[model samples]
Target: MLREETAKLLMMIQGAYPNYKPDNKTVTINTWNLALSDISFDLAEKAFLAYLRADTKGFAPAPGQLIALVHELNTPQQLNELEAWSLVEKAIRNSIYNSQEEFSKLPPLVQKAVGSPNVLRLWAADGSYSEQVASSNFMRSYRNEAKKQEEYEKLPADMQQMIDQTNRNSYSAQIREKNRDAIQIMTTTENAEIEVKDEPTGISQQSDERLKKLIEDFRKI
Candidate 1:
């Protein structure tokens, strides 16, 4: 929201709660603008109205609270666990022959829970598959996926980018650690000439050079 819009919102809040007062009006406006600039004025106003209707405490909402309200207003309605399970159950009826089509028709969250068309087909063809167990599992998975998507959507753009970068870095570190372990195992089993030394230094110079070369090769990979 723009500075003017933010000021208008604060005015609305102040009007609602006469006792609420800010030490510095200009600072408050600037702070609110900084927090809500990504939101449009219309959406912010709607969020304010929604909060006003639901508020039990007569206190004015903080900037962070307004942001949360904005996100709540913006998020699309999601199917409940029972409703999602019903869709899956319907799809399973035709999954034996038209699993791909049925799977494609499901919502993204439902598709994530189902995993694949083949999985759906398996559930349909397998007589031993229990509807009670499958329904419970699919509902649980759907709820989990929905929650993850909601939380991710509520995060700020910068925070989302930071999380993505952290995940990538963590995955890269795992891969590197696995490769290092594999290289160590290969060195131990494949290179008999390179021997461990009991001297002050742990490994022989030849073994050290070979290990260094292996590390460099793994780095390239």
Candidate 2:
């Protein structure tokens, strides 16, 4: 799990170090090694956050030493474009370096773009895949809405389709994003999908109690 999150953090930082050349040679946030000393499913969430905070004050990157260590983690070359970008981002973020005057001395444009929350979260997921899955939380209610339709289909001829299908021309969908902080809710979704079946109660009831409980839990965040 931490590996998944680390993969995301890498993607975000790659954006920070775009190929475009900056006026200043100084590096703002030096990413050291992303590979944690150790990790497991238990510490996945906290471990994920710790990597981001690693770039902050206390966890400043070292000199060539830390940066040199990044090359060791071997992400597959066949990774999608987004995946490739994330692997790079994680490397730079976790690479060795510090908030030296050299980094601070850089201009504001570089600072804001690199340190932005969206960027941070982007990197957290390696790419938007996990984040996208995460977003399914509230929006997944739409699936319940879909499942409701599926249920209604199972109904006798007397029943009505209450789902207000969207028009093709006005098909604007809002995407829910996942982040390290809000990851567990995604897990609940998988569990919900398997357990929440339509046959037990039938569409008349449309009782997706399991999925509902998970979505409600995510809403708290």
Instruction: List per-prediction Cα lDDT, in the order shown.
Output: 0.78, 0.35
For residue 210, give model 2's deviation from the true position in Å. 2.3
Candidate 2 lDDT, 47-68, residue by residue in tens: 3344445545333223222222
Query: How well is each residue in 90-118 modelled by candidate 1, as lDDT tens digits?
Result: 99999766676787799988987887666
Clashes of each: 1, 27
Per-residue lDDT, model 1, residue 202, is: 40
TM accuracy, model 2: 0.18
Query: Candidate 1: what lDDT?
Result: 0.78
TM-score of predicted structure 1: 0.64
